[model samples]
Target: MFGWRRRNRTGRKTGRSKKQQFKLDKESVLPNHFRCPISLDLMKDPVTLSSGITYDRESIEKWLEDGNFTCPVTNQVLRSFDRIPNHILRKMIQEWCQENQNSGVERIPTPKVPVTGTEVYEILSSIEASMKRLDQCGFLESLKKINKWGFESERNRKCIVDNGTATTLANAFVTFSSDDHHQSLESHNYNVLEEILSSLNWMFPLENDARKILGSKPSLNKLVLLMKRRDFLSTKNAILVVEELCYDQEFIEALVGIEEVQEVLVRFIKEPICHAITKASLMVIFSMVSSSNHDHERIKTQFAEMGLVTLVLNMLIDGEKHLNEIALGVFDRILDSKEGREAACGNDLTMPVLVKKILRVSELATEYSVSSIWKLSRIEKQSNEGRVLFEALQVGAFQKLVLLLQCGCGDSTKEKATQLLKLLNPYRAGLECIESSDFKNLKRSF
Candidate 1:
């Protein structure tokens, strides 16, 4: 390749091919055609969808995996998810990288050949044989293969999940949980169980029958026992499985019905094993708290009575932004019940924390916190020791409430905010003039 030289600012001769990292800017622009529409990065393994648009194999596969049946660019219903390999384009990218090697462009290796149905069947058969013969060592090896293959590409995972690997794994999980086999292999049990759950997490949106297997009361009781293992990997995987299966109304209600399950989830929240597990636990509990299967009030009251109110308040006090937002949403939902309200009011920190989170967190957090305040304050000012309003007023909630109305919110939230303002208006006398970063945005004329 011919090379050229350029001059530096000091008039020294410098090479034009000086190695540097490429970023999205005019100086080192990546060709538009080389970039995947979904990720906007140079495609290492381009594949054309049936819609005739090319994207990185991984990006497009993930899009389809998320249940989008249409082209992301065209939004047209896809007749198929077939993604033909664009080999020619990949070669062009390689040549360009070779010509610009000095510019830090590395050659993209060819993507792994997508897993075939036959390959998946071979692994599934191995898992089944090992399980039937009670070969613990063989069973663990086969599960390792499933986890590995599923990680290579979304296509592989699709193949694994579609070939009924999920049901097989679920059945194996049930046996391990119910049978006494696990107790004998105490130390090795963690590895086998972790792989099973880690692989299962990749097969979410489980089939209805599969959902029932994991949702059964016995399975759930065992799931609690697994969590108590205190192994981070196993606990995280277990939480993710429950989070996905919890999409079903029946699974949620079933988990809630188990006192042990409730206690375990609450413990996970009170002292998280890790951030990811903690967040997933919140999602599962949120689903449980939000269920409308038969009696909505019953579900709300159940969580409210389990010290969820106090836990949420404490989380809001120190949780990160997104986690705080979720905690507030749960707080608002539970507040719909009398028990939830009583629990909040009983804790003297409730009003202060709820009022504090209103404008201090994200928009969604603000809405939920405001809604919670409205719910807690909706009762007669004469009732509940007047703790709701007086405590709110004592914390300067009246000013924050005014600022919230100034910022605006959903129509329902808007109405509730307005009603809240009216309720707190009479107590506004002698309060310091509203002042804060949020107050500066207020229209002086209004």
Candidate 2:
């Protein structure tokens, strides 16, 4: 009976052995020690949480990202979300995978060492000490490291700024900028300035107080001179810092008083600088003109004659979609003054291009573009500029308004569009081609 059973089992195994071998050739299950508790897979860049739980770095980071203050598995309260790298475990996993290569396992690649806030703090401390002795090389290197780390995480950025990173960076910027004034700027100086710029760029979305502190420290003249630098990085940072500085009325006045400031800004606005630089420059202009004050009006006149109205209109016509909304926003601000209104309406392309942007971009863009038309139309209605009214008619402004009402916009935008249509009601003959049901339905409301 035993012999018969053995023969039968051998017969059953003959065809199944190859299939079983194929299954075994696949990657074997990872040993528990080599697996992340969170991922339940072989650990890649294993780290120990404050809860004393080991997990994959990315998995644990994501858990923390989801706003968890406890370990996912243990449910224990975590004193901190900071992770300690389990280098020994990572090495063991790598060696184990290498030893198990016959089972078709792939080696886990090493992970990049992330920059920590502590590291940034230490660097800042060293730079603070070095700055006292006027040795900038170490300060420059440390600033570069801080900038790099700032880009890594929002938490790290906040840490840097909260620790007075901007004040430190601002002082360095002024020092280097003043040094350049005493001599022709060397390549090394430009390199140092560029690094300072990188840090400033990362340190933005700052509070008004922080901006004020930074702006005052760097000094307006130094910032404007930095704006004259032709390099993309420094130019971009210069304008960004200037825009933030313009939050203060005095700084705005000071910046506009600088003759080179407007020239450099307009030149780059028309020049082939990167879109980011152009955007920053436009925002500075916007901030200057956004507020209603004597200084703002004067600055508006300064920019209007410099052909800012024309330049913004042309940007609207030819610029990318990302730039369209900002251009319209600045265009709206430019409309606050009589000179700006005349500049905007004087352009043959302005009415047509302005009308084209109504529903073509974002809702915010539509609101701004429509608001600009309202401003122009309001001025025309009061001044009896039949020619300007005729231009809006010729550009299908009335029809776009009718369509905008039908399509639905923000409440304020809808009201502005309605108000604009009423202003243009005398020119309703221009919209004679409207035949769509939506347009027809909207006409009754109009």
Candidate 3:
């Protein structure tokens, strides 16, 4: 490689590197067939489809990934997913690059062969056998190999998944979850669990059968075991899986009935794991008792009895902006039920804390905070009207509501702020001076 000093002409050394100085000549155009039709660039790894159109392997793979099954150039429905490598063409390209070594074009490295479905099945068999006999070394080795293969390419990972390995791995994890497995947990098996989780993460948005296996009683027990272990990687991966399962309504109902699951999820928030785990824990809970769920009222009563109200109050006192938004969203749902309202009202910090969050965080957070105060105060007035309004006003809910409406917010949020403002207005006598600015428009709604 020639250094800049050697290529310099006008005394000072040129800043260009050898590759830049040797860039492919624009005048010496590349052969048209050598370029990928999609990227319009020289092909690195050429492969042909059943439609007889050739494309760079990476480009075609990406096109397929985006859910387009048609050949890009031919516009024909691809009869197969098979991408036969054009070895002859690749060799020709390599020879041409070598013949023009003076140019910046470098020969592309040989693309690694992706793991086939057959090889994936073979590895799955090894993992199953290793798990059956509790062979720590064998299991760890297989898990690491699975991770390596998955890391090679998204194609390889998809092949491993197509082989129905996700369910097998989940069942294996369930078997390893019992105290029987805990006897050997502190050794290599512990780290092996992380590897298993890594492999599972690669196959996420798991197939229906795999989700059924993971959402089962055995797997729920396994998640509880992992969370209780308090090992960072294990807990993080376990919660992520739990979060994924939360999307299924059936699983949400089943998970809500599991006190152990509820306890661990709440403890993660209370004790504070990493932000991701904490946020995921909250999301799981939110999914469990969201109003969209049929059993939301019953679930709300259950979580309120478990002190979810107190936990969120503590979180909002010091949590970051996004966490505050989620917590308040959960808080909004909690107050929908009579039990949640009572639980929130029992705490002295409840109204004041809701007021504190109103305009202090992100716009979404303010919406949640304002909606929560509106919910609680509206409900609490049935029993304790004096104290609810007193606390909200004392904490400056009135002033925050004025500014929130003036700054402009979502239509729903704007309506919520207006309603909350009306509720807190009568408590402040002679408030005529504050009506001319942002509140001028809101005064009509009030």
Candidates by TM-score, descending order:
2, 3, 1
| Model 3 C-alpha lDDT per residue in residues 343-413, reported as the tens digit of each score | 87777767667776766778877888888888877775667556777677766778878888888989998
What's the residue-level lDDT of 290 in candidate 3?
85
**TM-scores for every predicted model:** 0.72, 0.79, 0.74
Model 1 global lDDT (CA atoms, 0 to 1): 0.77
TM-score of candidate 3 against the unseen true structure? 0.74
Which segments of candidate 2 are over 4 A away from where they belong? 1-33, 39-42, 49-52, 61-70, 77-82, 96-106, 112-117, 144-164, 175-191, 206-210, 243-254, 429-446
For residues 1-446, what per-residue lDDT tens digits would candidate 2 score against the true structure? 34333224546423346657666555356677777777777778899988787898878887887888999989989988779999988999999889877776778888767766677678878887766666778887777677677676665676678777777777766666666655333434667766776667767766555566556533566567677877666777878777767667767766666667878888888785888788878777777788656677777787888888878877875688998888898889888888999887777777777777888988999999888888888888887866766777766788888888999989988888888878777866635432222221211100
What TM value does model 2 have?
0.79
Question: What residue pairs are clashing in model 1?
Answer: none
Judge candidate 2 at residue 242 and give its lDDT.
78
Write one digit per residue (lDDT tens) for candidate 1, span 1-446.
Answer: 32356566987555543333233232355678999999988899999988888999889988987889999999999988888999999999888778777766678887887887888888878888887776789999888877888898777888888888888888877766665545432544556666778878878878777778888765786676677667777788888888888778878877777656777788898886778888888888788778886777887887788788888877766677779988888888898889998888787667777777877878888888888888888864547455577667767777787777788777887888889878887766765533232322322210
Give me the displacement of residue 255 in model 3, in angstroms: 2.8
- On the 0 to 100 scale, the lDDT of residue 210 in model 1 is 75
Candidate with the larger TM-score of 1 and 2? 2
Model 3 misplaced stretches (Cα beyond 4 Å): 1-33, 49-53, 62-81, 88-107, 125-141, 175-194, 291-311, 336-367, 394-418, 430-446
